[model samples]
Target: MSPALHRRLPLLATAAVLVGLYASGGLLYDGFLSGRVALNLLADNAALGLTAVGLTLVIFSGGIDLSVGAVVGFTSIFTATLVERHGVHPALAAAAALAVGGALGAGMGALIHWFRQPPFLITLAGMFLMRGGAYWISTESVGLTHPLYNRLAAYELPLGGRLGLPVTSLVLLAALALGGIIAHYTRFGRNLLALGGSESSALLMGVPLAGTRIAVYALSSLAATVAGLVLALYTGSGNPTFGLGLELDAIAVVVIGGTLLRGGRGHLLGTLLGLLVFGVIQTALTFDGRLSAQWGRIIVGALLLAFILVQRLLHERLGRRRDPIHTV
Candidate 1:
């Protein structure tokens, strides 16, 4: 296999599954076989894809972030609440959400750096805090009726005729492009990979280790905030509990995209492929309505486990350094 194809082996397999689903979609619902479904697929994957992009960076830096689901939850709820209760401008509300998300990320980064606690524990605490905070903001789900939010959320640019690209999707794609540039061209990007590879050595080599890791988390939060806003707009409502299991999905997408879960290795293209696979699976599952969404989770978990096992076996065969965490 060529380098690019080898790198995206998992995604390529997922694409085959997507084609299978599309074929199966015809048998279940003729509507699902339409171009509309394809449009919806892109729309549905946009927010998840954006969040996964940010997460790919954090994972690449050798850290796990559990607070992302909560952060997206919090930001979504906050956006809707502010529009309904305070009449905040959509632009200003968006800015506030991003700033708060960044602050939360910075806090978690500080905790990990200063206390020497594993990120798992710190972000777990963050998850609860943000989830509860979402409830505190609104005990009930809220939908947007504001003229501004409605206009912005539903706005579409003419891509051709009946087919059009949504403003939300366009903005999300723009964010993805910006993230790709940051990941490949910047000093911060190099530092993130170097730090994950060997923090001690990276520091000794003057890679600005602390700042890079801290910023990576912050960027993750910022991306989550952006997704949250788009979600509120598209759904015309906020579900504080909506992203309950999304962090796992994001992590799975990162890994499936060809990014290593253990960190120090990953790319944006891998994440994009991962999102495509996830979208295809969900689309296929929806076509078979008799199957529960719960089954989707089970399948996702199985896939994650299988990929992890493959990595471990590869490492063993290569005689690379073994991880102490999962050896037993």
Candidate 2:
């Protein structure tokens, strides 16, 4: 395969898997192929989709963020407390949450870049700190009764014949579009891939190592905060425990989307497809109505493992194909 084709294989595989899953679901379940069902998948996993977009950026830069779920939970409680208790405008409260999330990510990134600390360790510490902060703000779920939130929760765009797209889904799509553009069309994105491929090479090629690292984390955290806001709108409440284990889900989405866990290659569109696949599985399970909810996690775990193995094999094959001795 040509170099370009090699780069595209994972994405192609992801799309194929997603399509196959949808086709199987449609065949197995009555009325499972409707527009409403499709729309609901996006609506239900909007937050996960958005967070995965951000995580895609980090992974592209050869970094991992274990704190995404905690940041999301913290933002929910933080924004809710500001709006409900302090009587702050909802918009302002959201801004505050975004700022805090960005700051937290930047701090973690700085530690990773400057101190040469492990990304996993720094982000793990960050996860604890943010989760603690959420509990500090409020151990219980805080109900959001603000008019803005209520309006947003009720907002939907009709698609004819009892089908509609929620505003949250639109937000997820917009985020995906923006992330796609950044990852594919911009210099920063190119540098991110380069950094992921090899940090020394990227630095030698003039990639701003420190700045890019910080920016990547900041963007991830900002996306996490936005996801939290969407979750708050969806649930009409803020719980410190919101988004529990979502970081793992977001990582799984990225991996299933064909992004290399080691980084340097992937597509935002693939992540979107991965999210759809997850949603389709969940919907299928729901339609069955007999399996326990834990089955969803079990299936996802198996899929994640399969994708990881595929990625490892692909990487090894590509490496060998590029080796002059092997080619000869």
Q: Positional deviation of 212 in candidate 1, in angstroms?
A: 0.4
> Per-residue lDDT tens digits of candidate 1, residues 6-111?
5455555555655665666667675777766777776887778778888888887889898888888898899888878898987888898999999999888888
What C-alpha lDDT does candidate 2 achieve relative to the native structure? 0.91
Candidate 2 deviant stretches above 4 angstroms = 323-328
**Clash count of each predicted structure:** 1, 0
Give per-residue CA lDDT, model 2, range 1-328, as digits (tens). 7898887788888889889989999998999998889888998998899899999999999999999999889999999999999999999999999899999999999999999999999999999999999999999999999998988888788878887778899899899999999998999899899999889989999999999999999999999999999998888899899888999999999999999878888888889988988999999999888888999999999999988898888888887877555334
RMSD of 2: 1.8
Candidate with top lDDT is 2
